[model samples]
Target: MSELDDPVGSSLHGPHAALARRVGRTATYPADVATFCAVPADPAPQDWADLARLVGPGGLADLFTAPGTPPPDWTPEFAMPGRQLVAPVPTGDVDPRVVELGRDDDPAMLQLATATRPGPFFARTARLGTFLGVRDGGELLAMAGQRLHPGGWVEISAVCTAERARGQGLAAVLVAAQVARTAADGGRAFLHVVDTNAGARALYARLGFTQRRPVLFRGFRVPG
Candidate 1:
């Protein structure tokens, strides 16, 4: 396998590193950060530091802790530890159960998420692209959505399933649908997950996704 194909070397290192290395340089601003998706490269060390600051210490720790940020202890083993999962989606043979949702659907989606309480990023992701979900008798069970980065890669996020609906494969089905949509649009599907969550990681692996890399964020402190 090529260097990029090595899960430990490439995927496990996080997209920022790949993006920086691809461009042979580093991004200077938030807007420029998007460019790395289009042109992969190793993020300048300082840039990564700058980014951590922008996210704030609390936000940084929260993100590193899980697929979704809150409810603390929702998925004990899935707590974030400065790592994330970036998986590739195979479009063929998608599960028909998955459906695309809209902002108008926010109340239902948020309601489902709140019961499970994935994280704050879920609300932010709904603004990016079509949010996909699986419903059961008119109730949202599991959901995932897109977050575009520089138009090159679409981050698959907000993956959460209702506690009562676990083990139905709803999360996997929604992810496949979103990934198919992303690849069909000429962009790659990527996501962030906590380092531990073996169950979720195994699901992604079954879908042919190899772990890309770990990402950590530190918050920037405000001046007194």
Candidate 2:
């Protein structure tokens, strides 16, 4: 429960430790790597200060559902109601069409993510974990991959399908592949979706993912 309670923090302290930038107990990834910042579950004032220092003045503190309020000087950025979904161990083989992405694919990956606005992606994001994609010849049609690794759970993130590829079940195929990979790695699968995205929620439900808990996707601008 604690891991899920502070997913970004737990991930910074765990599998993604190498990518973390720390100042006291607060931590975050490099801006290009991710905008996520992690504060302790019951964050104190000093923890906020530590986070401010880590992200620097005027930077975004994208605390991905960590608990605590930023000080008065920190301006609110955006807050969206979201929910976490967990999936049972998958039961099928990855589709042969699914391909593992690598460094050489950075440009195409970034292009596809930018066009689809899946989430925060950067040149090095693929380093976070395994990313699987479906391509139609030279163009990437859809993709999904591992993001946060909190405790024994893996967060499937950045799922998106090109407009031309929509309605072809590419998103479902990629998600299924990610879930199967999560199970193969001895981990559980989970994800977060904004409450307004009814379509995505329904899709996840159809894929056997159940709502685990409600979450708030929040961010703040560090005081200058």
Candidate 3:
């Protein structure tokens, strides 16, 4: 299978290896970094067994885009239809207002993501890759950053602007900055958007991203 088809697995096995925790053939990011788990594309019983043990009883098995259904006892948490889009790096200068965020910016980053509900951002999610933000004075107004690194591609995620800051094109600026950064590292950029978010889909299209495939973002609770 293409690495993109099993991005979580490919990331754990490739670029994000050091950040992974493995239990037999299953792997997952740390709880504070991300909740994503990776199982074999065509999961066998043992693969499910490994995932159960890795997350422990009652823990969430956030199977981000992997198709295998868990055992009958696993309770569904959520299932969202999303599309993966890919784009060539755009040639442009990053907005002068954009700044690279560092460890000190974690609290603000987490707060903004929580308020914006952009995606599954966590306390240490910034460790996944470079994060950039736009701040107005001391207040953070918008942000975007990289997440999964599957072979030659980087997943741009958590692209969001504050409620009061929308319509200023901050989301577009932040996304473009993220794409530029990925290009600097010799990787192309891609992102996942909920299929129902027509506005986001249109924005990405304007930035030159085209749908690569539909994906499902799923999470389930491990049976106790």
Candidate 4:
């Protein structure tokens, strides 16, 4: 058949899906979108069968792979096109003020992330990877951190700055800091952004991130 015939082991196309299946807190939706959900990245045929059996009927999930690539027999609710950007080793040190956030900071992080609409930030998202943020006068101003870490690459995600703190380059610092940290660990840094977000794309460009490839995010609802 074609290269897309069986998308197993195809997570090289989407890091989020890969990371999700690897380290994400996975759960099935008991009450549809009203409850929690999980994703399987680059699922092999067996992986799809396993997840399908696990979730059963009355469940839903979301995952991403290369555009037009869904595992055999899985259906997609929607597909969102996006751009993937990769940054090289940072040239400077992370600012001293950027602090690592812990579980205690989830409340503030969730608020900031929700207000900024950077991406998904759930209650226990802190367990995903290292999250760093900047605080100004006791207020969370900006933040960014690791996401998918498959192989030698760590995906930088949740880069956001409070509205009151915009135009100050706080987002840049957080992104650069994440990139620097990833490099220090002997790994590369990358991220995914909606292709239509011109402002974010510009900022990432200025931070020395180049467009690596076009990606697609596919969300699916298992027959529930």
Q: Residue 9 of candidate 4: its Cα lDDT?
A: 25
How does candidate 1 fare on TM-score? Answer: 0.62
Ranked by lDDT, the better of candidates 3 and 4 is 3
TM-score of each: 0.62, 0.97, 0.97, 0.76
What's the alpha carbon RMSD for model 4? 5.9
Q: In order, what lDDT does every prediction score? A: 0.54, 0.88, 0.91, 0.67
lDDT by residue (tens digit), candidate 4, 20-65:
3322323232221112234343435555555556566544445553
* Distance from true location, Cα of 195 in model 1, Å: 0.9
The Cα error of candidate 3 at residue 87, in Å, is 1.5
26, model 2: CA deviation in Å? 0.7
- Residue pairs of candidate 2 with colliding backbone atoms: none
Considering summed lDDT, which 10 consecutive residues are worst modelled in model 4? 1-10
Pick the lDDT winner: 3
Evaluation by lDDT, superior candidate among 2 and 3: 3
Candidate ranking (lDDT, best to worst) = 3, 2, 4, 1
lDDT of 3 by residue, 171-218 (tens): 999999888888888889999999888888999999999888889989
Q: What's the number of clashes in each of the models?
A: 26, 0, 0, 1
Residue 37 Cα positional deviation in candidate 2, in Å, after optimal superposition: 1.0
Candidate 4 or 1, higher TM-score? 4
